[model samples]
Target: MARRERPARVPPRWVVTGAWRVHRAIYRVSGGRVGLWRPKPGRWGTLRLTTTGRRSGQPRSVLLGYYEDGRNLVTMAMNGWGEGEPAWWLNLLANPEAEVEVRGGTRRVRGRAAEGEERERLWARWREIDTQLDELAALRSTRTAVVVLEPL
Candidate 1:
């Protein structure tokens, strides 16, 4: 009898390090078209956020989700099963002044920490996506702020 060859797998799972790098690649590949949205958090859309370079003061675009609070955008650096935050989020930490690009449009946003009522409201929404985020939120909740996009 002849030996049979085994079939190969269709597609391989991605093997990469760094949360933001994985995040950026996913955004680019999908073109920010598809995302799984659950009601608890309202919406989890494509990563099309643009932030300013910490040093150059230029624009930096990446994919991310925005939780809503009336007209404001709520976001976080939630890396599932990971402990550290991403570089982009760190960049925002370095310089809260940043921008975001979404659906072919752009917005200039100023990052500031949410306080009291604002934090509670956004935290309620944040809990929806990942429960693990609660730990992160607790650490960042006070310092966590909304990116208030202004007319540019």
Candidate 2:
């Protein structure tokens, strides 16, 4: 039997952006007590990432979903499964150095786009986490970047 593919299920752009804003607001209101989590055996985790703004030279923070690959953390530079790259990702591209706050503690790290075999392996891992990863990725015109955050 031939296999069939399902269309990607993504929310409206405004709804997606609004959700991110609300999550950040909750994190701020709770004084960092909530909104962050650690990756589990079969699930991804949320982390608060702080990067230096490329043009402003100031700190900028965003929440990202990641999984552990040895001591390194891996995430995708997807903008709510939207068209353009996210601002946080652009900032990281300008200055690879950044900080991340996880459930147990914080870490200073350097970010880079995964490539070649590294990207394939990491992206496969993400596919395990999100079965629709490829479908969602197809929504964007440009290729989504698999980001690796290595400890500094």
TM-score of 1: 0.58
| lDDT accuracy of residue 65 in candidate 1 | 68
Tens-digit lDDT track for model 1 on 88-133?
6767777776766655455677666567886676677676765445
Q: Which candidate should be chosen as best, given lDDT against the real structure?
A: 2
What C-alpha RMSD separates each model from the true structure? Answer: 10.2, 2.3
Per-prediction count of colliding residue pairs?
4, 0
- TM-scores for every candidate against the unseen true structure: 0.58, 0.94
lDDT of 2 by residue, 1-152 (tens): 99997778899989998998999999899999999888887689999999999999999999999999999999999999888889999999999999999888999999999999999999999999888999899989999999999999
| Best model per TM-score | 2
How accurate locally, in lDDT, is each candidate?
A: 0.56, 0.94
Q: List the residue pairs that clash in candidate 1.
A: 47-63, 47-64, 50-99, 50-100
